[model samples]
Target: MYKSQIKIISVIIIALFGFILFSQDLEANSMPSLDYSIELQHDGSGIVTEKRQMHLTEGTEVYIVFDQLEGSEITDVFVSDYDEPFTYQENWDINASREAKTGKYSLIPTDEGYEISWGIGEYGDHEYTVRYTISGMVRQLKDGQSMLWRLFQGRNNLPPKKFSITVTGPKYFDPELTKIWGFGYDGEIYLEDGQLVSWSNQPLTGRNHITVYMQFLDQPFQPTLSWDQTLAEQNHQALENNSYQNEDDTTDIVAVILLCSFLGIGVLIVILASIYTAKRNKAIRAANPLITGIKRTEMNEGKVYREIPYSEGNILDVAYLLQEHGKGDMEAYFNAFLLKWLKEGYIVQLNTNEANGDKLKLTVQLLDSNTPELEQQFFDILLSAADRYGVVDTSDVTRWAEKNYDKITELKASLPYESKRTLIDRGYLYNEDVYFLGNFRAEVTKSSYQGEDLYNRLIQFENYLNELLSLDRVNLQQQNINEDIIIWASLYNLVEPFVEKFQEVEPAYFVTHHFNYSNIYLLSLYSSGFSSGYDQAVTSHQTSMGSGGTTSFGGGGGSFGGGGGGVR
Candidate 1:
């Protein structure tokens, strides 16, 4: 009887070990899945509802966390097990260890996010559902409404098995002009059943986020055509009448006599004066023909080859040029300087690789020494702003701007004065201020002296470069730099050839990774017309979101969906 009992005990222990291993394997292979749906209205408000499911073993407790959304009021929180309601523990201590908990479930609030805990009574697998409502998700625009949805926040450890978001709106809503941006992941937006705009991602893992932006037009666009026969007839008659002219030949003999008498006296005076002046000029020219010819040549050259006296092949010059043209835009300024630096060999492109279908990575090195004072200053500022890794990536330009925001602001503030000083030194300006008096003149002229209108400055710079390079303005316009990439390349290509004509050969150096010249190229292109369109879009979007602006959902400091569960 003792031997049989030992045999049964051993078999039971073996079965328990096998069951434990199987449960561990199952937990490792499975993850929770989530689904979200948001219903929006035209008045800048919306509701967000979601459902999630996960599997757990018996006695294992799971915690569901919710991340707070910015500019949103969350309410109507509900949690349940499948279709059944689960009771929550009151007065639960969040600081207590997970193993110390004796309750079946608890909802505890924390600084980072809310935690919902549940103990599994008996489970091979289980599913839980959560739902919440978010108000003020949409922003009111002048003509319509806009919404920005951040799809990935508050997610940790729970690698989504599948995730989807659907946004439904009124029947008049159009999804064609919707804009979507994804970080660390890619997603697609499309119309569903003509009224809903849906965005979806599946099997997401490892910290990913997405943003969806949509603008709804207040009214549907309708084209109309109407022609007025009577108006056309009137226009034709007006054109015919204006095309004809009548000549008046009536003469006044006394007036003609007076006019001829004055004209003859003027001619006699001019002839006498011309003869006297010619004789004096002949004597002066005969005395110094070489000097006269040199003076004349200099005057003609000044008209034909008017050079922009300021330095052109450096970063500061580009900044000055940009400000002069009223561009004052930081990205365009950086892009212009980047082109100059690349051409002057201050920055060298070392290697290139395709990062993805739409992205390119370039390795670059910054050469030390031998740059202009201003260029070196700008270069050092950039070097100082490098990441902790001691290297700069082309993609980090925006980050660089953010990290050195104060310096950048100071640089922008001093740029106008520096630009004026450079111009004054070059004799472009007589002084800091040029004044014009009118009957109703008041205050200062901010546009010209204060660097307000950058577009005008750009035109002036363009004209200056055209004359300096002896380029045909008509031909340059015909090349259409905006549409022709070859022409665009050729225009900037002038920088290197011009510099090489004057500078010494030097080893090129600058450090960079994933630097794509196209980014800089596109930036320079903005100097033409694209920048205006970008500004308009940004302005419109900002105006729609109101003064405080629409906040990014997952960017808040508090935890909304940051807490998760672990298997025990």
Candidate 2:
């Protein structure tokens, strides 16, 4: 009885082991096989042909996904079986409820690539041939044309049994000059009668894809300069006409001489008036202790001199203050604004734990609740979204800009329009209309402004800020007052006398002290009360497939089509 019981247990264990081995064999057989080929052209185009074979179970359906080449215009896509042709669609969602109805196969376009699904009637063996033409596959190098051909990066779900590629180009192409690199499988390339051919028959295990980089020996084709030559000839004729006019216009030349003399006299009068006004203002400022007190208080407190009756709410106000103080250094004023904000607790520096001597490795973060609306707009809409943790890291800002490009563009387009409307509503501008009598009468209108020179200067200041924001953070962070010192001096000429006096009082301290303090003030004001990064951050969150040319694929038991697939 004991021997019989042991025999029964042994038979059960043997049967279980056999079943596991059979299942593994079935999984291996289910993977699809691919055979691919391509023909190249000198004008950076290619015609690709692929033959695929897939094995399906009794109730399973197979979908073949193909990755479209980047920057290439694909056309003439065709899919066929041994007996009949397959129907295809472009840019179709695979998850959508659709049916081939009667056909054996159907092809659909996806964001990353294309998908081809076919029903296996008997679940034995199925074969399909796909063909397509791609234009602009070759990239232009400095001296010649190069092509980076990638395969097996996409459609990894359907593993290929054998893959082959043949590149046929111009006779001038030399295989010796062509360099190739393989990613997944080691492949061989040989020049056969002036044509470059490559093939691989290894199993794609522990590999992503294969990339072949080929540089042609021949120089890139260049068209003759017929249009440029014509343009040069036209420019020469214009110069000849100008020379002829110079010889003929004696009366016009005399009129020019008179105009120049009058202009020179006007310039001299303006310069004399400017010199007189400067001396007079200097005398007045020297006598007035109130103005002197304000400058002294700003230097001591490291904030905008609120006692001067200049608005301190917006960047425009800062520009007005600088202009009124006879200081043209926007950079200095901006630095002062930063310092003020820091003092007000709008922005705080978070110290890094990493040690780098006494040099501050600090990231700026918004802190206070009393940020001005304009500053809040800049902080929430621009700066905060740049860093993940609301810390203003320059590198993070660049990465954020790349990911949220649409938000950047929308802000750029809308800000100027909104500013214009605000200025108009504030009585800074009036609409001027002009009527033109053409084939059809029409009216053209534009904003006409009154003589508020400060308002115009404020507009220019805003333009400068926009230009700064548009720059990459690397360039923006490198900006310092010394680079544009001449422009700053002109802008701050009103405050130059006071600044000189302050410099004399503390000869070595003025430049470093003022600049550093001002920067802190500006940052604090800019980031105050803004927790969210960009105003459009919420709206910008959506699905994205990323930039690679590869598509992804997955198989669900019920339906063959769903999910995207691509090649690298």
Candidate 3:
């Protein structure tokens, strides 16, 4: 009887061990996979609707990752627009659940990078795109959005994040008809039917919630360092102690040889020689003019020699020349460089991998698309810089560019576009082209409002300029050849009485002309798609209450982003 009982116990124990090993292997090789295909349809302008649902019974709302979907556009063909907007069209407004109810961003948190979504479409197919142009490499929804976020621990360390969440279509999605999309990240996922409702426990690197998200692991969440040095040191100490306790007292033969090598005369001589040579080369390179940048390139290369015009006092000219030459002085921009470039048309690179511990690449191109001429200019510059120092494909130029671009872009966050734009209007970019530029500059003393409140009161002044630009638009509609007469009059501070005629036709608040310069607001917004959301994404940074009651927001608010907020 005793022998029979022992045999039964042994079989049970073996089965349990086998089952444990199988489960361990299964866990080591699995992750959640998404299964929907994306579709983009055009025409059939009757109207279209987009609906989103939250499936978790306890959860009130959910967030979708955006920015990754660059190059794609969304359109609200026609939706029911109630008295109040139903869909949160602007990204700035937080998502509010009508049912359970609470306003919160579609993206609450994330281990890294935001997961944003928007109802995108073509403006007759021309409303610029932000998509997966760099899908696998250098993550960013588009230009301004960063894919550079990092986490300290494993994935799922933080909650999900979102940016530019849009739900356009007032008449149709005015109040939004809701539905549940899927269960929360914690619901059980049944692979057999593919109907799994499981919470996404994937903590991204850099967050501390990995322990809470990953439930099945018997061990604690590992530190995000990928390899924790402190823990490693502790483990190594324990190992050494154990080895000491179980070993022979004498040192091993291999250890003796390594010890002698650490103090050997021959090794010491080699170390000294290498250090001396490195220092000598460093000194020589510093004094050599050929190693500097532009001047050196001109002396060595013979294919082309176009000297950039430089300016003396103005900083704008210096910035423009540095960007063009591909190799030159790199410290001449304040918020001035980037703001000017973005408004006109330029894209700067901020990727770290491309920034070889150097400057940034401030690439300026048309916002519409890349032209062949532009491509040639870029490649030519890139190739020239590489050749100048035998950095040939070492990625030195691009590295410098990416860092420089990133710094300027971040700087733009604090600058106002008014002063920046005016500087360009008067022709400051040419100052540096002369000595730096071909000699670009405009007298600030002769500029509007002088430098007293150049930045603080720029938007209002810009409004005036826009109105002047509007005079040109009238020439487009009515062959009024006297267009220059009206424009010149406005520039010289004499258009007050001339603009009163436009008050009756514009929206109530937009009327009632104030200063000699501001009627430019409406004209500017109309051309730039700034006044309203009907045709284009108009941005006005300053919140204003004008004649009838126009509440203007985002008026060139000093180098702000397009994916900043919702438009009216």
Candidate 4:
């Protein structure tokens, strides 16, 4: 009805539309990116691999154009069929580190966009293949093998990626490859055979990804064998062919397996119970070690200890040992250390006062006395004992002081205990304990506390202003899934391979891929193992002594060590 009003409204509408368009363009251009990286460490044990997130936009694509995969043999390709927050990216770029004798892959752009020409052509002994496409995963088969495949709806949104894979292994056995599906971005798929697992949540975005993996073959021969030989060697049936088939033997074998399974479950229960008991305590490690000469922030000792327990005192204590090994200083490192050891229940607090009369004062407490040098000495002593007694190095005789010495030395050292007992022969925590552990190869000296001969306790003190006005309790949320169950799953995953990698029923391969989506991401432009892939001095580790080589096999074994290769 009114021309002026109508004209004004129209102008506003036009401006609003333009703003919306501009915002969308900005979002598309600067969206978070994912880089798909596959790392392979060459310790004869096998590949220790990982993936990465790269810088990307809605329409941007990265291609991994590798000219060579340098190792004694490409035993297995490290790929995961995970989805959301993590899907695999395609490899691109064609320059060789060495020669022009090798060329990059060819490309053919297509209709909807450019269809990446992948895994089709062979470049050389060195090759490039589209391991898997991240963005366009349209059809996931129903066999349920992808590590990124989800079973719950809210976990992740399917990004519709796809690939038709055809792998003909130099086979001793080949199972009819099955179709895997029913993927929940944050759930599991339970088949009569195996299951897929994950640890993240997602409503996957435009450039986000998920990953799935194939099975692995553990036959020592498969890495170099053509397929049939690998199968023949892997499918060895000595036990099946044995002449020991008494009905009694069948009964005995069944009985033995049952007994072992029951025993295993019992052990698992004990471990789970122990860990649960450990975590539920909600205790920060003993923080008897005091902070000296700091006047910045009034550090909540509990929070600081939970995150970084090592002291920055003038005295050279465990904190200094950590510094020697690259853990940061009192300002940076101790805080983090405390956070991990928070539930360990070992910290203590010293007295506090005011600095500027308005600010808070602080006193120094000494907690950890073990130094890095001490830990090494413990190891050295163990090796000397091993050499003297003629015990195999495999025994690691010096490392086993758990319930006994663990409580005496490590536990006491972890607290505000005055001194480690000097009586080594009477089992008092002493230089003798170190001597005994070092001699027997039993770890008498726990890692950080292995050496405590470094402090004079002449540390100074300072006043720190408390940052928080209120020392509120931190609300640490519990994971919904029983951590015990997850640990069981992870441990089994880390252990069950011997059986799976050796079984010879049909054509088969199994791959176990896990995503540790903690805030701890692979930070450096971090390439591993030097040349083609990446490897760094592993900053983190599995805590227990029982790592890779402790499994007991039934019969005699062949010499199975292989030479580790260098990057060309």
lDDT of each: 0.43, 0.42, 0.26, 0.24
lDDT of 3: 0.26
Clashes of each: 27, 32, 110, 110
The TM-score, computed over Cα atoms with residue i paired to residue i, of candidate 2 is 0.33
Model 4 spans > 4 angstroms off:
1-200, 211-568
Model 2 lDDT tens row, 305-405: 11222232343333423333444232343334334444454545555555644222124466457765444544554354445555654334434544454
Candidate 4 per-residue lDDT, tens place, 213-236, comes to 222323212122122222223112
What is the C-alpha lDDT profile of model 1 across 1-568, one tens digit per residue?
Answer: 2335445655675466546544554334244666667766444445555566665543356655545444444455555666666666677654555455433466566665455666554454556665555555554434444454454432334455666567676454543344322222333444555444333344554344434444444423221211222322322232222211221212234335545645665575566556555655555444332221233334334332122322343335434544433444444444455555555545543333555544432233565667655545556544664455344444344434433444655665666667656644544432222222222111221223322223233344344444434434343333222212212223333433322221222112111312233444433442333233334334323322111123222221111123234333
Best by TM-score: 1
Instruction: Tell me the TM-score of each prediction against the true structure.
Output: 0.34, 0.33, 0.17, 0.19
Better model by TM-score, 2 or 3? Answer: 2
> For model 1, what is the alpha-carbon lDDT of residue 9?
57
List the candidates ranked by TM-score, beginning with the highest. Answer: 1, 2, 4, 3
Candidate 3: tens digits of C-alpha lDDT, residues 187-271: 2211112111122333211111111000111111121112122322322232222221232322334345544644454365456
Task: Return the lDDT, model 2, position 548.
Answer: 14
> 353 in model 2: Cα distance from truth in Å?
69
